[model samples]
Target: MNETKLRDEIVGLAKSMFDRGLTFGSSGNISVRLDDGWLMTPTGSTMGTLDPARLSKLDINGRLISGDKPTKEAFLHTTMYERRPKANAVVHLHSTHSVALGCLHDVDPANVLPPLTAYFVMRIGTLPLIPYFAPGDLKLAEAVGEMASRHHAVLLANHGPVVAGKTLQDAVYATEELEETAKLFLALQNLRTRPLTSEQVADLHRRFPQNI
Candidate 1:
Protein backbone atom coordinates (compact mmCIF):
# COMPACT_ATOMS: atom_id res chain seq x y z
CA MET A 1 0.00 0.00 0.00
CA ASN A 2 1.09 3.58 -0.63
CA GLU A 3 1.99 5.64 2.41
CA THR A 4 -1.19 7.73 2.16
CA LYS A 5 -3.55 4.79 1.98
CA LEU A 6 -1.59 2.88 4.61
CA ARG A 7 -1.92 5.77 7.00
CA ASP A 8 -5.65 6.01 6.41
CA GLU A 9 -6.09 2.27 6.85
CA ILE A 10 -4.18 2.38 10.10
CA VAL A 11 -6.41 5.14 11.43
CA GLY A 12 -9.58 3.34 10.35
CA LEU A 13 -8.66 -0.03 11.83
CA ALA A 14 -7.37 1.55 15.02
CA LYS A 15 -10.64 3.44 15.45
CA SER A 16 -12.52 0.21 14.96
CA MET A 17 -10.50 -1.39 17.74
CA PHE A 18 -10.78 1.64 20.01
CA ASP A 19 -14.54 2.01 19.52
CA ARG A 20 -15.06 -1.62 20.44
CA GLY A 21 -12.90 -1.10 23.57
CA LEU A 22 -9.96 -3.19 22.40
CA THR A 23 -7.83 -0.40 23.78
CA PHE A 24 -8.57 2.51 26.07
CA GLY A 25 -7.04 5.92 26.58
CA SER A 26 -3.72 6.02 24.73
CA SER A 27 -2.69 2.58 25.90
CA GLY A 28 -2.14 0.84 22.60
CA ASN A 29 0.17 1.34 19.60
CA ILE A 30 0.39 0.29 15.96
CA SER A 31 3.15 0.42 13.32
CA VAL A 32 3.46 -0.53 9.70
CA ARG A 33 6.80 -1.25 8.02
CA LEU A 34 7.74 0.83 4.99
CA ASP A 35 10.49 0.47 2.47
CA ASP A 36 12.14 3.64 3.67
CA GLY A 37 11.18 3.53 7.34
CA TRP A 38 7.98 3.08 9.34
CA LEU A 39 4.67 4.80 9.84
CA MET A 40 3.63 4.64 13.49
CA THR A 41 0.80 5.94 15.60
CA PRO A 42 2.09 8.95 17.48
CA THR A 43 2.85 9.04 21.18
CA GLY A 44 -0.13 9.72 23.45
CA SER A 45 -2.53 9.81 20.51
CA THR A 46 -5.85 8.05 20.95
CA MET A 47 -6.46 5.45 18.29
CA GLY A 48 -9.99 6.77 17.88
CA THR A 49 -8.73 10.11 16.59
CA LEU A 50 -5.38 9.51 14.91
CA ASP A 51 -4.51 12.08 12.25
CA PRO A 52 -3.09 10.35 9.22
CA ALA A 53 -0.87 13.27 8.27
CA ARG A 54 0.45 13.54 11.80
CA LEU A 55 1.42 9.92 12.18
CA SER A 56 5.10 9.52 13.02
CA LYS A 57 7.36 8.70 10.13
CA LEU A 58 10.64 7.16 11.23
CA ASP A 59 13.70 6.37 9.20
CA ILE A 60 15.21 2.93 8.90
CA ASN A 61 17.21 3.40 12.08
CA GLY A 62 14.05 4.45 13.93
CA ARG A 63 14.88 8.14 13.98
CA LEU A 64 11.83 10.31 13.50
CA ILE A 65 11.78 11.92 10.08
CA SER A 66 8.43 13.71 10.05
CA GLY A 67 5.02 14.02 11.61
CA ASP A 68 4.52 13.69 15.43
CA LYS A 69 6.68 11.84 17.91
CA PRO A 70 6.37 8.09 17.82
CA THR A 71 4.92 6.06 20.66
CA LYS A 72 7.25 5.40 23.61
CA GLU A 73 6.64 1.75 22.93
CA ALA A 74 8.04 2.21 19.44
CA PHE A 75 10.90 -0.14 20.19
CA LEU A 76 8.41 -2.93 20.65
CA HIS A 77 7.38 -2.57 17.04
CA THR A 78 10.86 -1.98 15.70
CA THR A 79 12.25 -5.01 17.43
CA MET A 80 9.55 -7.22 15.97
CA TYR A 81 10.35 -6.03 12.49
CA GLU A 82 14.06 -6.46 13.08
CA ARG A 83 13.61 -10.02 14.19
CA ARG A 84 10.86 -11.02 11.81
CA PRO A 85 11.76 -9.76 8.37
CA LYS A 86 8.56 -11.07 6.81
CA ALA A 87 6.39 -9.13 9.26
CA ASN A 88 5.06 -5.97 7.66
CA ALA A 89 3.10 -4.67 10.62
CA VAL A 90 2.96 -4.89 14.42
CA VAL A 91 0.22 -4.25 16.97
CA HIS A 92 0.57 -3.83 20.69
CA LEU A 93 -2.64 -3.56 22.64
CA HIS A 94 -3.78 -3.54 26.24
CA SER A 95 -6.92 -5.43 25.41
CA THR A 96 -8.88 -6.50 28.50
CA HIS A 97 -9.14 -10.24 28.23
CA SER A 98 -5.57 -10.71 27.02
CA VAL A 99 -4.28 -8.70 29.93
CA ALA A 100 -6.43 -10.72 32.30
CA LEU A 101 -4.93 -13.91 30.95
CA GLY A 102 -1.43 -12.50 31.38
CA CYS A 103 -2.07 -11.88 35.08
CA LEU A 104 -3.01 -15.47 35.81
CA HIS A 105 -0.40 -17.08 38.10
CA ASP A 106 -0.31 -20.56 36.63
CA VAL A 107 -0.53 -19.99 32.93
CA ASP A 108 2.10 -21.56 30.73
CA PRO A 109 4.94 -19.27 29.75
CA ALA A 110 5.99 -21.34 26.76
CA ASN A 111 2.59 -21.27 25.09
CA VAL A 112 0.23 -19.03 27.01
CA LEU A 113 -3.10 -19.86 25.43
CA PRO A 114 -4.66 -23.24 24.80
CA PRO A 115 -5.73 -24.36 21.35
CA LEU A 116 -9.27 -23.28 22.03
CA THR A 117 -10.18 -22.77 18.38
CA ALA A 118 -8.77 -23.57 14.96
CA TYR A 119 -8.51 -19.91 14.00
CA PHE A 120 -6.39 -19.16 17.06
CA VAL A 121 -4.17 -22.08 16.27
CA MET A 122 -3.78 -20.89 12.69
CA ARG A 123 -3.25 -17.16 13.21
CA ILE A 124 -1.36 -17.18 16.49
CA GLY A 125 0.02 -20.69 16.49
CA THR A 126 1.96 -20.40 19.75
CA LEU A 127 2.24 -17.49 22.14
CA PRO A 128 5.06 -17.09 24.62
CA LEU A 129 4.94 -14.97 27.77
CA ILE A 130 7.65 -12.34 28.08
CA PRO A 131 8.73 -11.43 31.61
CA TYR A 132 7.38 -8.16 32.90
CA PHE A 133 9.44 -5.02 32.62
CA ALA A 134 8.42 -1.52 33.53
CA PRO A 135 6.98 0.54 30.69
CA GLY A 136 9.69 2.03 28.45
CA ASP A 137 12.26 -0.33 29.84
CA LEU A 138 14.58 -1.41 27.02
CA LYS A 139 14.66 -4.84 28.60
CA LEU A 140 11.04 -5.35 27.69
CA ALA A 141 11.85 -4.77 24.04
CA GLU A 142 14.71 -7.20 24.29
CA ALA A 143 12.47 -9.82 25.82
CA VAL A 144 9.98 -9.38 23.01
CA GLY A 145 12.77 -9.53 20.45
CA GLU A 146 13.97 -12.84 21.83
CA MET A 147 10.60 -14.39 21.07
CA ALA A 148 9.66 -12.46 17.93
CA SER A 149 11.59 -14.59 15.47
CA ARG A 150 9.84 -17.78 16.51
CA HIS A 151 6.41 -16.57 17.46
CA HIS A 152 4.55 -13.77 15.72
CA ALA A 153 2.38 -13.34 18.81
CA VAL A 154 3.40 -13.00 22.47
CA LEU A 155 1.70 -12.07 25.73
CA LEU A 156 3.60 -9.69 27.95
CA ALA A 157 3.48 -10.76 31.55
CA ASN A 158 1.17 -8.38 33.41
CA HIS A 159 0.72 -6.44 30.16
CA GLY A 160 -1.09 -7.61 27.05
CA PRO A 161 -0.17 -8.86 23.59
CA VAL A 162 2.21 -7.89 20.76
CA VAL A 163 1.41 -9.43 17.41
CA ALA A 164 3.09 -9.12 13.99
CA GLY A 165 1.66 -10.11 10.65
CA LYS A 166 2.40 -10.06 6.94
CA THR A 167 -0.29 -7.38 6.73
CA LEU A 168 -1.82 -4.92 9.15
CA GLN A 169 -5.25 -6.52 8.84
CA ASP A 170 -3.79 -9.93 9.53
CA ALA A 171 -2.10 -8.61 12.66
CA VAL A 172 -5.34 -7.10 13.91
CA TYR A 173 -7.31 -10.25 13.23
CA ALA A 174 -4.74 -12.39 15.06
CA THR A 175 -4.79 -10.10 18.06
CA GLU A 176 -8.58 -10.24 18.20
CA GLU A 177 -8.51 -14.01 18.01
CA LEU A 178 -6.10 -14.15 20.91
CA GLU A 179 -8.21 -11.84 23.07
CA GLU A 180 -11.40 -13.81 22.38
CA THR A 181 -9.68 -17.10 23.14
CA ALA A 182 -8.38 -15.63 26.38
CA LYS A 183 -11.95 -14.69 27.31
CA LEU A 184 -13.15 -18.22 26.58
CA PHE A 185 -10.32 -19.70 28.62
CA LEU A 186 -11.14 -17.51 31.60
CA ALA A 187 -14.80 -18.43 31.38
CA LEU A 188 -14.02 -22.14 31.15
CA GLN A 189 -11.58 -22.15 34.05
CA ASN A 190 -13.92 -23.72 36.57
CA LEU A 191 -15.54 -26.15 34.18
CA ARG A 192 -14.12 -29.23 32.50
CA THR A 193 -13.30 -28.31 28.93
CA ARG A 194 -11.89 -30.06 25.93
CA PRO A 195 -9.36 -27.87 24.20
CA LEU A 196 -8.06 -29.09 20.88
CA THR A 197 -5.69 -31.97 21.31
CA SER A 198 -2.07 -31.86 20.23
CA GLU A 199 -2.89 -33.93 17.16
CA GLN A 200 -5.66 -31.57 16.14
CA VAL A 201 -3.45 -28.53 16.47
CA ALA A 202 -0.77 -30.22 14.42
CA ASP A 203 -3.30 -31.00 11.73
CA LEU A 204 -4.38 -27.38 11.54
CA HIS A 205 -0.77 -26.28 11.25
CA ARG A 206 -0.25 -28.74 8.46
CA ARG A 207 -3.35 -27.65 6.63
CA PHE A 208 -2.58 -23.94 6.89
CA PRO A 209 1.16 -23.97 6.81
CA GLN A 210 1.39 -20.40 5.61
CA ASN A 211 -0.42 -18.93 8.62
CA ILE A 212 1.71 -16.38 10.44
Candidate 2:
Protein backbone atom coordinates (compact mmCIF):
# COMPACT_ATOMS: atom_id res chain seq x y z
CA MET A 1 0.00 0.00 0.00
CA ASN A 2 1.11 3.59 -0.58
CA GLU A 3 2.27 5.59 2.43
CA THR A 4 -0.97 7.52 2.83
CA LYS A 5 -3.19 4.50 2.50
CA LEU A 6 -0.90 2.50 4.76
CA ARG A 7 -1.33 5.05 7.53
CA ASP A 8 -5.11 5.01 7.25
CA GLU A 9 -5.19 1.23 7.11
CA ILE A 10 -3.09 0.94 10.21
CA VAL A 11 -5.30 3.31 12.13
CA GLY A 12 -8.49 1.58 10.97
CA LEU A 13 -7.29 -1.90 11.84
CA ALA A 14 -5.95 -0.79 15.18
CA LYS A 15 -9.32 0.65 16.03
CA SER A 16 -10.98 -2.57 15.03
CA MET A 17 -8.75 -4.60 17.32
CA PHE A 18 -9.26 -2.17 20.16
CA ASP A 19 -13.02 -2.04 19.71
CA ARG A 20 -13.18 -5.79 19.77
CA GLY A 21 -11.18 -5.94 22.99
CA LEU A 22 -8.18 -7.67 21.42
CA THR A 23 -6.09 -5.15 23.30
CA PHE A 24 -6.96 -2.68 25.99
CA GLY A 25 -5.34 0.41 27.44
CA SER A 26 -1.98 1.06 25.79
CA SER A 27 -1.03 -2.56 25.80
CA GLY A 28 -0.27 -3.23 22.16
CA ASN A 29 2.00 -1.86 19.44
CA ILE A 30 1.91 -2.04 15.63
CA SER A 31 4.34 -1.15 12.86
CA VAL A 32 4.68 -1.20 9.11
CA ARG A 33 7.89 -1.01 7.10
CA LEU A 34 8.35 1.82 4.64
CA ASP A 35 10.85 2.41 1.86
CA ASP A 36 12.52 5.16 3.82
CA GLY A 37 11.59 4.27 7.40
CA TRP A 38 8.92 2.69 9.59
CA LEU A 39 5.55 3.85 10.85
CA MET A 40 4.94 2.77 14.44
CA THR A 41 2.41 3.42 17.15
CA PRO A 42 3.73 6.05 19.52
CA THR A 43 4.90 5.17 23.02
CA GLY A 44 2.01 4.60 25.46
CA SER A 45 -0.46 5.31 22.71
CA THR A 46 -3.66 3.33 22.93
CA MET A 47 -4.66 1.51 19.79
CA GLY A 48 -8.30 2.43 20.40
CA THR A 49 -7.63 5.99 19.38
CA LEU A 50 -4.57 6.25 17.21
CA ASP A 51 -3.94 9.36 15.14
CA PRO A 52 -2.37 8.41 11.83
CA ALA A 53 -0.59 11.69 11.44
CA ARG A 54 0.96 11.39 14.89
CA LEU A 55 2.21 7.87 14.49
CA SER A 56 5.92 7.62 15.11
CA LYS A 57 8.20 7.66 12.10
CA LEU A 58 11.69 6.20 12.26
CA ASP A 59 14.46 6.17 9.73
CA ILE A 60 16.01 3.03 8.30
CA ASN A 61 18.27 2.76 11.29
CA GLY A 62 15.29 2.94 13.71
CA ARG A 63 15.91 6.47 14.88
CA LEU A 64 12.95 8.76 15.27
CA ILE A 65 12.72 11.30 12.46
CA SER A 66 9.24 12.77 13.02
CA GLY A 67 5.91 12.47 14.84
CA ASP A 68 5.69 11.31 18.44
CA LYS A 69 8.19 9.02 20.19
CA PRO A 70 7.99 5.46 18.97
CA THR A 71 6.71 2.65 21.13
CA LYS A 72 9.09 1.71 23.90
CA GLU A 73 9.31 -1.75 22.35
CA ALA A 74 10.15 -0.39 18.93
CA PHE A 75 13.27 -2.51 19.01
CA LEU A 76 11.06 -5.55 18.83
CA HIS A 77 9.61 -4.34 15.54
CA THR A 78 13.04 -3.35 14.25
CA THR A 79 14.45 -6.75 15.10
CA MET A 80 11.70 -8.54 13.21
CA TYR A 81 12.23 -6.30 10.19
CA GLU A 82 15.97 -6.86 10.21
CA ARG A 83 15.67 -10.60 10.66
CA ARG A 84 12.75 -11.21 8.31
CA PRO A 85 13.35 -9.35 5.09
CA LYS A 86 9.89 -10.15 3.75
CA ALA A 87 7.97 -8.94 6.78
CA ASN A 88 6.38 -5.57 6.09
CA ALA A 89 4.41 -5.35 9.32
CA VAL A 90 4.64 -6.43 12.95
CA VAL A 91 1.90 -6.71 15.56
CA HIS A 92 2.52 -7.05 19.28
CA LEU A 93 -0.19 -7.27 21.88
CA HIS A 94 -0.54 -8.03 25.58
CA SER A 95 -3.55 -10.14 24.77
CA THR A 96 -5.13 -11.95 27.70
CA HIS A 97 -5.56 -15.54 26.60
CA SER A 98 -2.16 -15.77 24.95
CA VAL A 99 -0.54 -14.31 28.00
CA ALA A 100 -2.43 -16.79 30.12
CA LEU A 101 -1.12 -19.61 27.98
CA GLY A 102 2.36 -18.16 28.22
CA CYS A 103 2.16 -18.12 31.99
CA LEU A 104 1.14 -21.76 32.20
CA HIS A 105 3.86 -23.94 33.71
CA ASP A 106 3.12 -26.86 31.41
CA VAL A 107 3.03 -24.87 28.19
CA ASP A 108 5.57 -26.02 25.61
CA PRO A 109 8.45 -23.63 25.36
CA ALA A 110 9.23 -24.75 21.85
CA ASN A 111 5.64 -24.43 20.62
CA VAL A 112 3.21 -23.12 23.17
CA LEU A 113 -0.07 -23.77 21.34
CA PRO A 114 -1.17 -26.99 19.71
CA PRO A 115 -2.61 -27.41 16.23
CA LEU A 116 -6.19 -27.55 17.42
CA THR A 117 -7.68 -26.39 14.15
CA ALA A 118 -6.75 -26.15 10.50
CA TYR A 119 -6.76 -22.38 10.46
CA PHE A 120 -4.38 -22.28 13.39
CA VAL A 121 -2.09 -24.71 11.65
CA MET A 122 -2.14 -22.76 8.41
CA ARG A 123 -1.91 -19.24 9.80
CA ILE A 124 0.34 -19.91 12.79
CA GLY A 125 2.11 -23.19 12.28
CA THR A 126 3.89 -23.18 15.64
CA LEU A 127 3.94 -20.73 18.50
CA PRO A 128 7.16 -20.58 20.47
CA LEU A 129 7.15 -19.30 24.01
CA ILE A 130 10.06 -16.98 24.75
CA PRO A 131 11.33 -16.10 28.20
CA TYR A 132 10.05 -12.92 29.73
CA PHE A 133 11.83 -9.63 30.08
CA ALA A 134 10.38 -6.53 31.70
CA PRO A 135 8.47 -4.28 29.33
CA GLY A 136 10.73 -2.29 27.02
CA ASP A 137 13.65 -4.63 27.65
CA LEU A 138 16.06 -4.72 24.73
CA LYS A 139 17.21 -8.17 25.74
CA LEU A 140 13.70 -9.38 25.10
CA ALA A 141 13.84 -7.87 21.64
CA GLU A 142 17.20 -9.54 21.09
CA ALA A 143 15.79 -12.93 21.97
CA VAL A 144 12.81 -12.35 19.70
CA GLY A 145 15.15 -11.30 16.90
CA GLU A 146 17.17 -14.45 17.43
CA MET A 147 14.12 -16.54 16.51
CA ALA A 148 12.20 -14.11 14.33
CA SER A 149 13.87 -15.51 11.23
CA ARG A 150 12.54 -18.98 12.03
CA HIS A 151 9.24 -18.21 13.71
CA HIS A 152 6.71 -15.61 12.63
CA ALA A 153 4.66 -15.88 15.80
CA VAL A 154 6.10 -16.08 19.34
CA LEU A 155 4.54 -15.86 22.79
CA LEU A 156 6.41 -13.82 25.31
CA ALA A 157 6.43 -15.61 28.66
CA ASN A 158 3.99 -14.14 31.14
CA HIS A 159 3.39 -11.37 28.68
CA GLY A 160 1.79 -11.80 25.25
CA PRO A 161 2.34 -12.53 21.58
CA VAL A 162 4.03 -10.92 18.58
CA VAL A 163 3.59 -11.68 14.90
CA ALA A 164 5.40 -10.56 11.76
CA GLY A 165 3.70 -10.68 8.40
CA LYS A 166 4.35 -10.00 4.74
CA THR A 167 1.79 -7.19 4.89
CA LEU A 168 -0.18 -5.22 7.47
CA GLN A 169 -3.42 -7.12 6.83
CA ASP A 170 -1.61 -10.44 6.81
CA ALA A 171 -0.09 -9.67 10.17
CA VAL A 172 -3.40 -8.53 11.65
CA TYR A 173 -5.33 -11.52 10.35
CA ALA A 174 -2.71 -13.90 11.65
CA THR A 175 -2.78 -12.18 15.00
CA GLU A 176 -6.57 -12.52 15.20
CA GLU A 177 -6.32 -16.20 14.42
CA LEU A 178 -3.67 -16.58 17.06
CA GLU A 179 -5.76 -14.91 19.74
CA GLU A 180 -8.79 -16.99 18.90
CA THR A 181 -6.70 -20.17 18.99
CA ALA A 182 -5.30 -19.21 22.35
CA LYS A 183 -8.81 -18.81 23.65
CA LEU A 184 -9.67 -22.22 22.30
CA PHE A 185 -6.58 -23.75 23.83
CA LEU A 186 -7.53 -22.44 27.23
CA ALA A 187 -11.20 -23.33 26.88
CA LEU A 188 -10.22 -26.92 26.18
CA GLN A 189 -7.54 -27.16 28.81
CA ASN A 190 -9.52 -29.59 30.95
CA LEU A 191 -11.83 -31.14 28.40
CA ARG A 192 -9.52 -33.86 27.12
CA THR A 193 -9.32 -32.01 23.84
CA ARG A 194 -7.84 -33.89 20.90
CA PRO A 195 -5.66 -31.69 18.82
CA LEU A 196 -4.61 -32.40 15.26
CA THR A 197 -2.07 -35.19 14.98
CA SER A 198 1.47 -34.56 13.89
CA GLU A 199 0.67 -35.97 10.47
CA GLN A 200 -2.31 -33.69 10.05
CA VAL A 201 -0.21 -30.71 11.02
CA ALA A 202 2.44 -31.81 8.54
CA ASP A 203 -0.17 -31.91 5.80
CA LEU A 204 -1.27 -28.37 6.54
CA HIS A 205 2.33 -27.26 6.55
CA ARG A 206 2.78 -28.90 3.17
CA ARG A 207 -0.27 -27.25 1.66
CA PHE A 208 0.58 -23.85 3.11
CA PRO A 209 4.32 -23.81 2.77
CA GLN A 210 4.90 -20.12 2.55
CA ASN A 211 5.51 -19.48 6.24
CA ILE A 212 6.63 -22.98 7.14
Candidate 3:
Protein backbone atom coordinates (compact mmCIF):
# COMPACT_ATOMS: atom_id res chain seq x y z
CA MET A 1 0.00 0.00 0.00
CA ASN A 2 1.06 3.58 -0.61
CA GLU A 3 2.19 5.53 2.43
CA THR A 4 -0.88 7.73 2.55
CA LYS A 5 -3.26 4.79 2.21
CA LEU A 6 -1.35 2.78 4.77
CA ARG A 7 -1.47 5.63 7.26
CA ASP A 8 -5.21 6.02 6.81
CA GLU A 9 -5.75 2.28 7.17
CA ILE A 10 -3.66 2.11 10.33
CA VAL A 11 -5.60 4.99 11.89
CA GLY A 12 -8.93 3.49 10.91
CA LEU A 13 -8.01 0.10 12.32
CA ALA A 14 -6.68 1.63 15.52
CA LYS A 15 -9.96 3.48 15.98
CA SER A 16 -11.91 0.31 15.34
CA MET A 17 -9.89 -1.47 17.99
CA PHE A 18 -10.54 1.32 20.49
CA ASP A 19 -14.22 1.45 19.57
CA ARG A 20 -14.54 -2.27 20.27
CA GLY A 21 -12.94 -1.82 23.71
CA LEU A 22 -9.94 -3.95 22.80
CA THR A 23 -7.92 -1.13 24.28
CA PHE A 24 -8.81 1.96 26.27
CA GLY A 25 -7.30 5.28 27.24
CA SER A 26 -3.91 5.66 25.57
CA SER A 27 -2.92 2.08 26.20
CA GLY A 28 -1.91 0.74 22.80
CA ASN A 29 0.23 1.50 19.76
CA ILE A 30 0.24 0.27 16.18
CA SER A 31 2.90 0.39 13.46
CA VAL A 32 3.51 -0.69 9.91
CA ARG A 33 6.72 -1.04 7.91
CA LEU A 34 7.31 1.51 5.17
CA ASP A 35 9.80 1.53 2.34
CA ASP A 36 11.49 4.59 3.80
CA GLY A 37 11.20 3.47 7.41
CA TRP A 38 8.09 3.02 9.61
CA LEU A 39 4.80 4.70 10.34
CA MET A 40 3.56 4.54 13.95
CA THR A 41 1.03 6.06 16.29
CA PRO A 42 2.45 9.07 18.08
CA THR A 43 3.32 9.15 21.78
CA GLY A 44 0.35 10.12 24.01
CA SER A 45 -2.04 9.95 21.07
CA THR A 46 -5.30 8.18 21.78
CA MET A 47 -5.79 5.41 19.25
CA GLY A 48 -9.43 6.42 18.78
CA THR A 49 -8.53 9.93 17.68
CA LEU A 50 -5.42 9.40 15.55
CA ASP A 51 -4.93 11.97 12.83
CA PRO A 52 -3.21 10.23 9.94
CA ALA A 53 -1.34 13.30 8.79
CA ARG A 54 0.46 13.60 12.11
CA LEU A 55 1.57 10.02 12.52
CA SER A 56 5.22 9.59 13.46
CA LYS A 57 7.66 8.52 10.77
CA LEU A 58 10.93 6.89 11.73
CA ASP A 59 14.07 5.93 9.86
CA ILE A 60 15.42 2.37 9.78
CA ASN A 61 17.37 3.18 12.94
CA GLY A 62 14.14 4.12 14.75
CA ARG A 63 15.06 7.80 14.79
CA LEU A 64 12.08 10.08 14.38
CA ILE A 65 12.32 11.66 10.94
CA SER A 66 9.12 13.71 10.83
CA GLY A 67 5.61 14.21 12.18
CA ASP A 68 5.03 13.89 15.96
CA LYS A 69 7.40 12.04 18.26
CA PRO A 70 7.07 8.29 18.33
CA THR A 71 5.67 6.39 21.28
CA LYS A 72 8.08 5.62 24.13
CA GLU A 73 7.26 1.98 23.49
CA ALA A 74 8.41 2.35 19.89
CA PHE A 75 11.29 0.05 20.69
CA LEU A 76 8.81 -2.79 21.13
CA HIS A 77 7.85 -2.47 17.48
CA THR A 78 11.34 -1.77 16.16
CA THR A 79 12.90 -4.66 18.05
CA MET A 80 10.25 -7.05 16.84
CA TYR A 81 10.90 -5.92 13.29
CA GLU A 82 14.58 -6.65 13.75
CA ARG A 83 13.81 -10.09 15.14
CA ARG A 84 11.22 -11.03 12.57
CA PRO A 85 12.36 -9.83 9.17
CA LYS A 86 9.10 -10.84 7.53
CA ALA A 87 6.86 -9.11 10.07
CA ASN A 88 5.77 -5.83 8.51
CA ALA A 89 3.42 -4.76 11.28
CA VAL A 90 3.08 -4.97 15.05
CA VAL A 91 0.17 -4.37 17.44
CA HIS A 92 0.62 -3.94 21.15
CA LEU A 93 -2.45 -3.66 23.32
CA HIS A 94 -3.41 -3.45 27.00
CA SER A 95 -6.52 -5.52 26.51
CA THR A 96 -8.32 -6.60 29.71
CA HIS A 97 -8.56 -10.39 29.49
CA SER A 98 -5.04 -10.87 28.16
CA VAL A 99 -3.58 -8.71 30.89
CA ALA A 100 -5.70 -10.53 33.48
CA LEU A 101 -4.31 -13.82 32.21
CA GLY A 102 -0.82 -12.41 32.56
CA CYS A 103 -1.42 -11.61 36.26
CA LEU A 104 -2.32 -15.11 37.39
CA HIS A 105 0.58 -16.48 39.42
CA ASP A 106 0.50 -19.95 37.87
CA VAL A 107 -0.26 -19.12 34.29
CA ASP A 108 2.38 -20.83 32.15
CA PRO A 109 5.24 -18.46 31.43
CA ALA A 110 5.94 -20.50 28.33
CA ASN A 111 2.99 -20.89 25.93
CA VAL A 112 0.72 -18.73 28.09
CA LEU A 113 -2.51 -19.70 26.36
CA PRO A 114 -3.81 -23.16 25.55
CA PRO A 115 -4.99 -24.38 22.14
CA LEU A 116 -8.60 -23.65 23.08
CA THR A 117 -9.75 -23.08 19.51
CA ALA A 118 -8.57 -23.70 15.96
CA TYR A 119 -8.14 -20.02 15.16
CA PHE A 120 -5.95 -19.61 18.22
CA VAL A 121 -3.83 -22.51 17.11
CA MET A 122 -3.68 -21.19 13.57
CA ARG A 123 -3.10 -17.49 14.20
CA ILE A 124 -1.08 -17.90 17.40
CA GLY A 125 0.78 -21.12 17.82
CA THR A 126 2.72 -20.64 21.05
CA LEU A 127 2.64 -17.46 23.12
CA PRO A 128 5.63 -16.98 25.38
CA LEU A 129 5.30 -14.84 28.50
CA ILE A 130 7.95 -12.21 29.03
CA PRO A 131 8.68 -11.05 32.56
CA TYR A 132 7.36 -7.66 33.54
CA PHE A 133 9.38 -4.55 32.80
CA ALA A 134 7.89 -1.16 33.51
CA PRO A 135 6.32 0.53 30.51
CA GLY A 136 8.79 1.91 27.95
CA ASP A 137 11.72 0.12 29.55
CA LEU A 138 14.46 -0.67 27.04
CA LYS A 139 15.08 -3.98 28.81
CA LEU A 140 11.53 -5.04 27.98
CA ALA A 141 12.28 -4.37 24.32
CA GLU A 142 15.33 -6.62 24.48
CA ALA A 143 13.36 -9.41 26.13
CA VAL A 144 10.61 -9.12 23.54
CA GLY A 145 13.21 -9.08 20.77
CA GLU A 146 14.84 -12.30 21.94
CA MET A 147 11.54 -14.15 22.23
CA ALA A 148 9.97 -12.60 19.15
CA SER A 149 12.51 -14.35 16.94
CA ARG A 150 10.77 -17.61 17.79
CA HIS A 151 7.18 -16.56 18.40
CA HIS A 152 5.23 -13.80 16.69
CA ALA A 153 2.91 -13.29 19.65
CA VAL A 154 3.94 -12.78 23.26
CA LEU A 155 2.13 -11.76 26.42
CA LEU A 156 3.95 -9.45 28.81
CA ALA A 157 3.53 -10.50 32.41
CA ASN A 158 1.16 -8.10 34.20
CA HIS A 159 0.81 -6.16 30.95
CA GLY A 160 -0.68 -7.46 27.74
CA PRO A 161 0.13 -8.92 24.32
CA VAL A 162 2.44 -7.91 21.46
CA VAL A 163 1.70 -9.46 18.11
CA ALA A 164 3.56 -9.17 14.80
CA GLY A 165 2.29 -10.09 11.39
CA LYS A 166 3.06 -9.75 7.69
CA THR A 167 0.43 -7.01 7.52
CA LEU A 168 -1.48 -4.69 9.81
CA GLN A 169 -4.67 -6.62 9.24
CA ASP A 170 -3.00 -9.88 10.21
CA ALA A 171 -1.52 -8.42 13.38
CA VAL A 172 -4.82 -6.86 14.46
CA TYR A 173 -6.72 -10.08 13.76
CA ALA A 174 -4.23 -12.17 15.73
CA THR A 175 -4.30 -9.76 18.65
CA GLU A 176 -8.07 -9.97 18.66
CA GLU A 177 -7.85 -13.75 18.66
CA LEU A 178 -5.46 -13.67 21.59
CA GLU A 179 -7.85 -11.49 23.57
CA GLU A 180 -10.83 -13.75 22.83
CA THR A 181 -8.96 -16.91 23.69
CA ALA A 182 -7.66 -15.41 26.89
CA LYS A 183 -11.24 -14.55 27.82
CA LEU A 184 -12.34 -18.13 27.15
CA PHE A 185 -9.45 -19.58 29.12
CA LEU A 186 -10.22 -17.42 32.16
CA ALA A 187 -13.92 -18.17 31.94
CA LEU A 188 -13.42 -21.94 31.86
CA GLN A 189 -10.64 -22.12 34.43
CA ASN A 190 -12.96 -23.46 37.13
CA LEU A 191 -14.99 -25.57 34.77
CA ARG A 192 -14.17 -28.81 32.99
CA THR A 193 -13.18 -27.48 29.61
CA ARG A 194 -11.39 -29.76 27.22
CA PRO A 195 -8.69 -28.09 25.22
CA LEU A 196 -7.55 -29.20 21.80
CA THR A 197 -5.13 -32.06 22.01
CA SER A 198 -1.51 -31.66 21.02
CA GLU A 199 -2.13 -33.99 18.09
CA GLN A 200 -5.02 -31.85 16.84
CA VAL A 201 -2.91 -28.70 17.08
CA ALA A 202 -0.16 -30.37 15.11
CA ASP A 203 -2.63 -31.30 12.42
CA LEU A 204 -3.79 -27.72 12.08
CA HIS A 205 -0.23 -26.41 11.85
CA ARG A 206 0.51 -28.89 9.13
CA ARG A 207 -2.62 -27.92 7.25
CA PHE A 208 -2.11 -24.18 7.57
CA PRO A 209 1.64 -24.19 7.43
CA GLN A 210 1.79 -20.45 6.84
CA ASN A 211 0.59 -19.78 10.37
CA ILE A 212 3.72 -21.29 11.78
| Per-residue lDDT of model 3, residues 47-114, tens digit only | 99999999999998888998999988999999888999899999999999999999999877888888
Q: Which of candidates 1 and 3 is the stronger one according to TM-score?
A: 1
lDDT of 2: 0.90
Residue by residue across 12-113, what tens digits does model 1's lDDT show?
Answer: 999999999999999899999999999999999999999999999999999999999999999999999999999999999999999999999998899998
Computed on alpha carbons, the lDDT of every model, listed in order, comes to 0.94, 0.90, 0.92
Model 2, residue pairs in steric clash: none
Residue-by-residue lDDT tens digits, candidate 2, 1-212 = 78889999999999999999999999899999999989999998999999999999899998899989999889888988889888999999988888888889987799988889999988888888889899878899889987888998888999889999989999999999999999998888789888999999998888888552
Error of 3 at 121 (Å): 0.5
Worst 10 residues of 1 by lDDT: 203-212
lDDT of 3 at 161: 96
Once superposed on the true structure, which residue ranges of model 1 sit more than 4 Å away at CA? none
Q: How much lDDT does candidate 1 score?
A: 0.94
- Greater TM-score among 1 and 2 belongs to 1
Model 2, residue 1: what's the lDDT? 73
**Clash count for each candidate, listed in order shown:** 0, 0, 0
Question: How large is the C-alpha RMSD of every model relative to the true structure?
Answer: 0.8, 1.1, 1.0
Residue 3 of model 2: what lDDT? 84
